[model samples]
Target: MTQLDTAPARLSPAEPSVAEPPAASAVARLTTASPLGRIVVEGDGSAITRLEIERAGALSTDGLPDAPDDLTRRAVDQLGEYFSGSRHDIDVPVRLTGTPFQRAIWEGLRAIPFGATRSYGELGRDTGRATAGRAVGGAVGANPVPLIVPCHRVLASDQRITGYSAGDGVPTKVWLLDHEGIAHR
Candidate 1:
């Protein structure tokens, strides 16, 4: 990921800048330091939309717009607290975009509690879809908001740490669980 200390591209006064507040409805990006690495958070002014833990030096912004927003600032602060082990939960507003099934799975994930975990099948069963384990796993994998949504708390059927889409993958998942005081094999 690019260095957060570096200033982002700024518009000159002579140029006609978009009148919209930075990150209000349009995309805004911010990077905050973390125990694992630098994290890039993308959002619309209303809610946090995306989060990426930098693994390689590269940061991804495939189709995202650039701007500043208060939501991003809040998210960064919350994340900082989380990494420092002072915050157990994220209270920031988040915009989750996904299919109905995915959204349901995401909500289920949110309820898993701090320092606890549930298997995909267990999550599906708890959500009243006992036979949709694979589907539930798919939804968890497609989660748009990772840390805030708490997808890392979801484990494999055997309670093993499985795939993690952020940072260094499964290792990052283990680290997160460990930070929450949850033991993981």
Candidate 2:
């Protein structure tokens, strides 16, 4: 809701080179962060398809205009509040797709309260896969909804604020933590 730019992005080597990546049946809108995009996708007319994190190649690919829909508009507004420290939780329906194990990991990630975080090991334990921290990391990385699902709230077992992949890098993780008024312990 802060920064808005709808310019087309040049493809990068890291991006999928498929001539067609499938038409995005969704629309993406910008958030406060530069590489962040909040998208609302639908499958059945009121049912949401996916609320996802899109870095780049999103706006044009999703065929989005500068503005958002009523639901997307609300999402943008609430996210703005979250980033500005006026909000802590999001109340919206989101549909996600993943393997059963990955879904379990993501579910555990959702249980981590706001302004709080868990280590990979802790998440693995919570999910009843005590020694599956690496699996948890894989699921965390595969999370379709990052901020909405709060994957940024997950950290390494040592409690160090590193290894975050979203945004430019770990500084973005620090910012999210700082915004939530949580300090490293």
Candidate 3:
């Protein structure tokens, strides 16, 4: 998959340890979601800015003046195109500012492939950190971008699917897994 004209330089985190992101300016923002909640994706001049899932109508652009305005609409539009199978990859720029380990996990998640999946353990191996299955699970759960990162493609070792903080519940996760033909119960 190719990144778009606006692809960020480092979708991956910068260090091997967890650290806070330095304050930066954003260039755009927008949101999209299932019936359960709303997810707002923002971007800086060159990468994604925010990927927070919020309660329905939770966005109160009341006073947060720096909130992005450009990329959010792009994220929503592209996401809609994705669900419809008209687009195969997320081409918009994304920053995914987080810990280095989280960035590693996200990178692995990025390779989960369309209509495919991996167990936590499987992802651990693919990430070249076999001992980090639980850690990978933690990162997967913490994923701000789901369908984009395709976190629903990760499953448990028991061959059962679980844990999704976004959307209404596990049903969306299950439906997504099923849609991918992951063979789960």
Better-scoring candidate (TM-score), 2 or 3: 3
Q: Where in model 2 is the C-alpha error above 4 Å?
A: 1-67
Write candidate 1's Cα lDDT for 62-155 as tens digits.
3455565887887888888888878777777666666556666776777777888889888788768999977887888877778887889888
TM-score of 3: 0.71
Tens-digit per-residue lDDT, 72-181, candidate 3: 66667776676666765666655465565677777777766777777888878876889987788888887756666778878788778777756645776776666555
Per-candidate RMSD, Å: 10.6, 10.9, 5.8
Q: Show how many residue pairs clash in every candidate, following the order shown.
A: 1, 0, 9
lDDT of each: 0.72, 0.57, 0.63
Span of 10 residues, lowest total lDDT, candidate 1: 1-10
TM-score, ranked from best to worst? 1, 3, 2
* Number of the top lDDT candidate: 1
In Å, residue 125's CA in model 2 sits off its true spot by 1.2
Model 2, residue 122: what's the lDDT? 87
Q: TM-score of each candidate?
A: 0.81, 0.69, 0.71
* True-vs-predicted CA distance for residue 132, candidate 3, Å: 2.5
